[model samples]
Target: MLLLALLMGGLQEAGARPNPQALSARIEVREHTARAILFELRVRNDSGHRLTLALGGRPAYNVLVKRPDGTLIWEWQRGQIVQQILEYRSLDPGEELHFEATWKLVDARGRRVPAGEYLVHGVLNLEPPETLVTDSLRVRVAPAKRRRSAK
Candidate 1:
């Protein structure tokens, strides 16, 4: 009976969440009591061998947090990416590392975000030979419900 119950629970849980591998990468979101949203990035190293979060295209792509329309929100310097390469090369089999990229609840133009849904994504871009990896996430912010006016 216990085995059957465990199996049922596992099936239910599997259907409850999205497949982590279906996307290019994964991030864990945490909402703090103060309402700050944390975006934690994690990449998969399936082979557990030396890996590269390589970039491709002209201008020798660097890591970036971009708006949904492809506007640059933030760009990491070449030196920074090189430092990451030095830090994360040759991932151990079955080992994963996490990084954090935080965004205030405003657009790149410094305008307040409306109560709606927006996408958060990462882009690794550069000149030819480097591969481009893009991963996106959906974020939603809603205003607290207002109290009804008493007649």
Candidate 2:
């Protein structure tokens, strides 16, 4: 009975949280401008032996921007045709990989976001059941400026 309970709880908990330490990875989101934001995802091989990472599909990672209320506003993979081919890459001990994407303060439908606070994060699409994600970042978008009319 105890083992059954542990298995049920542990499996659900493991998949619900970001496991950056599992791959010695770090993610950062920063405001490049009031109308743009940047995402940086870094992964390092801290193990002694070469670490092999299986890429689940094309564009192995993604960036997400959402409202403070958890409403998704932008997704890096939206409308992208990601190939469903598996690929592998090896990282030597102490080596690292970096991935980046920028959001232009727009929603999935390509409209400017209103001036407000938003949350952003990065997701690494590894093998099945082993996805990695970065903690959500809080960002603010400034109001758009009006265009000047020519005299």
Candidate 3:
């Protein structure tokens, strides 16, 4: 089990230094079962002022799973159809947002993936057409167990 934490500076102006008092993000990936995995993303507003995120629609954040060689396996928003309407989310000081999703150890096509080590990370959707990416975490998936047949 590996947990990755990332500190992101607040929205900065062109040629301006990053704001230390900005939102921070953390991600964690763990095995929920031999055939499933759990992904979590936590975002906190640590600054004194309220933080606002300009999102496109549902799912303000996304989780990505890929192999060590950078082969894309699964994504949290693969088949999700969200409204194109723009939405703004605000977080007060000391406020946090938590998001979780479960993957059945399957690929985007709903096929079972082989048991092995996979790299995973989280992406935060923001305005200005920029995204915040967290560090990658390595998680292991166990092999599936075969069921016995009754004679």
Please report, in order, the local distance difference test score of every candidate based on alpha carbons. Answer: 0.42, 0.70, 0.71
C-alpha RMSD between model 1 and the true structure: 13.6
Instruction: Look at candidate 2 and tell me the lDDT of residue 115.
Output: 91
Model 3 agreement with the true structure over 36-149: per-residue lDDT tens digits: 878887777777777555554566678899999999899988899855555566778888778887878899999999889998888776553556676787888888898998
**Residue 120 CA error for candidate 2 (Å)?**
0.9
Kindly give the number of clashing pairs for every candidate: 8, 0, 0
Query: How close is every model to the real structure, measured as TM-score?
Result: 0.50, 0.77, 0.79
Q: Sort by TM-score, best first: what order?
A: 3, 2, 1
Error of 1 at 147 (Å): 15
lDDT of 3: 0.71
Best by TM-score: 3
Model 1 lDDT tens row, 51-92: 333223333323444556766554434324342221113345
Cα lDDT tens digits, model 2, 1-151, are 0000000112224234332333565667643776677878777765555656665688888888999999998999898999987666777767877888999989999999999898887777766655567667777889988889999
Candidate with the greatest lDDT versus the true structure? 3
For candidate 2, give the lDDT: 0.70
**Alpha-carbon error at 100 in model 1, in Å?**
0.3
lDDT (Cα) of model 1? 0.42
